[model samples]
Structure formats: C-alpha cells, structure tokens
Target: MLYATASQTVGPYLHIGLADRYCDDLTGDAPGLRDSRIVIEGRVLDGQGAPVPDGMVEIWQANPNGRYRHPEDERTHLPLVDGFTGFGRVPTGPDGSFRFITVKPGAVPDVHGVPQAPHILVSVFMRGLLKHVATRMYFPDEAAANANDGVLRLVPPARRDTLVARRGDDGALRWDIVLQGEGETVFFDI
Candidate 1:
C-alpha cells in the first residue's frame, strides 16, 4: 500500500487483499506445510485521534519454524506446528484497542539466508488512513540477533526499540499500536 502525506490521506487505500499471495521474504518461497497461527489485535484510529471501531487489521506470518504457505519452498523436511492457521483478524475495542491470540512465529532468514530473529509481522487498515501501514512485531530483548536483522538495521536507532514488544509480568510479550501522533508504529516500504 502507498500513502501521500500532505493531502488525500483519507478516502482511499489500495486494496492490498489483492496481494493475498505471500511468500517468505527471503526466497519468495511458499511453506512446505501450513504451520503458522498468529493473531494480531489493534485499534483503527482517524487523524483526529478518534477510534475507528469498525476498521479491520489483517495479519500474516510464517509458522513457528519460519516456513510460509507459498508453493515454491523446498524445505518440507522440517516438522510442522499443529493447530495453527498462521493468520487471523480482530476489531478494536471501545477505546480503540484490539487483541489477538496467536502462537509465536518462527524465524525467517535474511537475504543472505542467514537466520534472523523471529517476529510477527502485522498490517493495520483503518478508517481515513489511506494505507494499511505494515510493520513487524519482534520478541523482546533477543539481544544477540535483534542487532543482526537486516530490516531492523534500516530503522533509525532510537526508533527500533519500539518495534519490539516488552515482556509482561506473565512472561508474555505485550505491544501496543499507536495509529497517529508521536511513536506510531514504524512502517516499512517493502
């Protein structure tokens, strides 16, 4: 999806659904078997800071092992995670927050085929925002490789931390999406 910041920032967002076909970011390869089951929940908001309650947030990611559903992948030797769909949707709450219950995603290698840190990639589509900004949600504090991700390397240093989730007291990762204002999700141009 594309957006023009100055004007007409509302009223149109290219229907990304048409690109329903997704392959692994690395090789444009599909999954050997279906294994990813991730849920993304967040609110859709307008420029005036109001919740767009009826908006939709679409999410897609690889299985825990980092395999996609694309047909060209050649790695079927790996075991598949069970009971996971690798995709899901959720609407925002009254205050403009949404929640999803999905399993943690596996890792996908970089352009060099070097295994990068694991993460859940999310897409936000709301009312008024012309495009569904796409960003990746990373596991908190995986220091060793967080510094190794090729994509993460592109974000300006100060903003990269917000891209990862922080661990909650319950040991689960928690991340919030702020549609507008300072600290909005760092969307990518990929």
Candidate 2:
C-alpha cells in the first residue's frame, strides 16, 4: 500500500519562473489585438482585505473563435486567429493588482454539445497555498449566454456575482478576487 506524500507549500518566489517578461503577454504582434482588444484588470485580496502582493495569476481560454490551440481540440469549423495562444500569465504588483490584455474568448461547447458561456479560466498561485486556486471569470455583458452556462448554475445565485467581471468605461474588465472572508470568489475543485 503506497500512501501519498505530503504536499509542499508555495512561496513568495513565484516571479522567477512565472513572471518573466516573455510569458506575460498573450496579445503580442497581432492584428487580432486591434480587433478584439480588452483588458482584464483586478487585484488579489486576502482575508483581511489586504493585497496578496506575491500572488501570480494565470489564465487559459479558447480564442475569439472558440477554438483552443491544443492539438486535441479538433474542431475544424472554428476560425483560428494568428498569434493568439489562448493563454497568459501575470504576477501581482505591489498592490496585488494583475492585468491581462487579450481578446474575449468565444463560447466553447460542453461535453454534451451545449454551448457554454464565454469566459476565461483563471488559476492563482501564491505563497502559503498548498495548491493553486481555480476559478472562472465570466463577462457581465454575456447575460443570456451566462444564464445557460452549466458551471455558472452550480454556484448559488447570491455568490455568483463574484465570478463575473464588470466592464469599466474604458472597456477594461474589473474583476477583483478575494481569497477569503465575505464575498470571496468561488473556487472550483477541478
């Protein structure tokens, strides 16, 4: 009988591998950037409403055409955009703010061919967390699609707002993430 070993804790040194300038941009040198430009900006807050300065945020999503870049995603009808890798990473600044510039992802189908809402898959890594936290950021404007999303329905109605990002006057999405306490962002096990 083999027992699993204890998990190791993450530390404040995530910048070494995750925050290198090369891995920070997802919309680099592409016309797609001009056409589908949007900024996802937010801060990572801790239980006491303080910024988690050492945290790192990573996002993965389908391209604007709803197609993933991975070879396993063999949907031929979906249009592919040049220079969009459907992934990005950024580190929290001194104030725990993080921002991602990328096109809004299109609706991807579920296992049963149901069209899920357009949303970005977010993962957060930081010191003191044994494992990263997983969440999704849905667009507040995608009301109809969001109403039909299978994953969004799982969250209780009252707390669901935590997952939706609001668009600002400048067209940037403001979606702050709280690690604990009231109004904490909903994290999924998977």
Candidate 3:
C-alpha cells in the first residue's frame, strides 16, 4: 500500500506498555541510596489549571558525581555511582501528580566547559500531544549556579522561575508543570 501510518498521540492507556512498574523509585535499595536520597514531586496541569491525569513523566540526570550512565558521556573526570541508572519514569496519578525518589544530581559542565547548575531533564507525554514536551528542572538551592547556567541565562528572567523547583517544608523538591496558561512552564525545543 506504500502508505504511512497516521501518527497517534499517547492517550490514557500509556501505563499499560510504557511504564507499568514503579519506575519512579530510582534509589530504591540501590547502592547510592544511602547518601543523598531526595524526592521530586509535582502535578501536571492543563491550560485551565486542571489536572492531566493520564500523562506520563520521564526524567534523566547525572548521578551525584555528575557522571551519566549513558555511553555517549565520555567525561573521564566525573565519577559514576554504582547501581544508579539516573533514569526515572512515572505515570501521573488520578490527580495528575508524579513523584520520583532519587539522589540530588551534581552540576555538569556546559559546552563551554562552564559548570552548569544541577538539573534534571524531563519529558512529558500526554493525550492530544503528538510529541512529548521537553524541559529542565533546576534545583532552587542553586541560585548562584543557576544564574550562570548557559541554558538558564538564555531564558527570559520572568519565565525562569517555572524551571526552578522549590524546596518543600519536608525538604523534598516541588516543581509543577503547567502545559498552557499565564504561567506555563518553559519547555525546550529539543
């Protein structure tokens, strides 16, 4: 038939084949769990400020030592953590909230060799989206470092707050994603 299949969006049934397991616990019993376990929690909201229950969120970051588990990372100076994969995927609950338990990531050098702020790469997949949205979550505590971050510096000052996660009362980080609205989170083109 030589016809291309139509593109389909990730609907409410994403959990079935994508991330059925409790994939959010990146530090569960892992060797690197004892030192710096931290929780990252947030909700995914739609344009009208309603929850997007069926969405899926995925995150990737370097270990505490700033070394990635991927083969493409060829930095010899960075130390890799044992038993830490630095990848997490979680399906949003009925309230559109997602959480992950992982160690605080270390700062990685930018393309110009300048140390960037500690951050996690996030991807959001949901119904009606032909492609997932990409963003970065920066730790709120790293204000100084974030100011010098190459990517953060490029973002308009007014919109930079959307990318920084706030520290909760219990010490966990909180960062919500607003897909569309007056305060929409800043998403990356990549």
Candidate 4:
C-alpha cells in the first residue's frame, strides 16, 4: 500500500488534504489568458466563535485605472480585466472559511478629477438576517490616502483600522469582517 504526502495532495492547504480539491469555479490558470488573480480568504464565525457554514460573501473592486467596470461609470480610460467579474462569491466550507481569487481593483474618483478613494466593496448574506449588510473595506496602512478618503472619515480615528485591509504578498490581501458581534465593523448608510 502507498500513501501520498499532504503536500502532494493538498498543495499549500493542510489537514483538509484530498478533500480540498478545486471547485468548478474558473479560478485556476486558463489556456489563453488568466484574468483570475489575487485570492482573499478568511473565516466567518459567529459570536461564539463557531464557523457559520452557510453564508455568501461577495467582493467588488475598481479597475486598475481607479475606475469601475460599470457602464454607468464615466471614467474614460479605466482598464478592465477581460474575464474578471470585479466581483466574486464564495460559500463557507465546513470550518466557515472561504476564499476567492480576483484582480486587484483600482481607485475611483469622487468628483471626476479627484480620486474619491481606493476601496473594496463587500456584501455578505446569512440565514435569519433580515437584510444583507453592505460595507466598504479600506487599507489601514495608507494613512494619508485614508485620511482624505470620504468614507474613512466617517469612521472615528481610533476604530478605523477595522475597515482597512492589509497588503500582503502580491495578492488582493486578506481580512475577517463581522456583521454583528463584539466590536462589530461599521456599516455605511450608503
């Protein structure tokens, strides 16, 4: 009898070896070109620190030129990744962890010429919740940019870090946000 090493079966993913094979999502490198880039992963846990197995998490970002991919956007030259959704959805695994690979979004302007701010849009849906929570994720380290950001100003200085994400490696970065718990992240009316 022969057994495979964990690395052989799971690559970098541990413990969940073999069981952690890829889903049918178009996340892997493609034949022609790969629009799939940058993975953001985190666990969604409850107040008691248990994983919420059933929920949906969505992330959206601007294009490389500080513009959105929406037709209504007036940006004349925002670069767009061919297949990247600018948005991606992920359902939690058994442990309540999910992951997504997408191209990093660019900053969008607030008043045409002025770049409004750089941010990522996050939407999460869970059972029993009356409505989905809409929120903005910002970068914590960018003090200068964040200070001038319209959205970041809404959050008090001491607690602003909760909304800002960290830059890691060459990927989209990582974060763990909460809807309603101790020290819940602020949600915007907009």
Better of 1 and 2 by TM-score: 2
Task: Extract clashing residue pairs from model 3.
Answer: none
Question: lDDT scores for all predictions?
Answer: 0.63, 0.89, 0.90, 0.63
Task: Output the number of the lDDT-best candidate.
Answer: 3
Q: Candidate 3 lDDT, tens digit per residue, 93-154? A: 88999999998888888888888899999999999998899999999889899999999999
Off by over 4 Å in 1: 1-52
| Backbone clash total, candidate 2 | 0
Which TM-score value belongs to model 3? Answer: 0.93
RMSD of each: 7.3, 2.0, 1.7, 12.3
Candidate 3: stretches off by over 4 Å: 1-7
Q: What residue pairs are clashing in model 1?
A: 30-70, 31-68, 31-70, 36-63, 36-86, 37-86, 64-106
User: Of 1 and 4, which scores higher on TM-score?
Assistant: 4
Give each model a TM-score: 0.71, 0.93, 0.93, 0.72
Candidate 2's C-alpha runs over 4 A off are: 1-6
Over 69-132, each residue of candidate 2 has an lDDT whose tens digit, in order, gives 8898999889777888888888888999999888888899999989999999999999999889
> lDDT per residue, candidate 4, 126-169, as tens digits?
66555567787776556788788877787898778778767667
Error of 4 at 163 (Å): 0.9
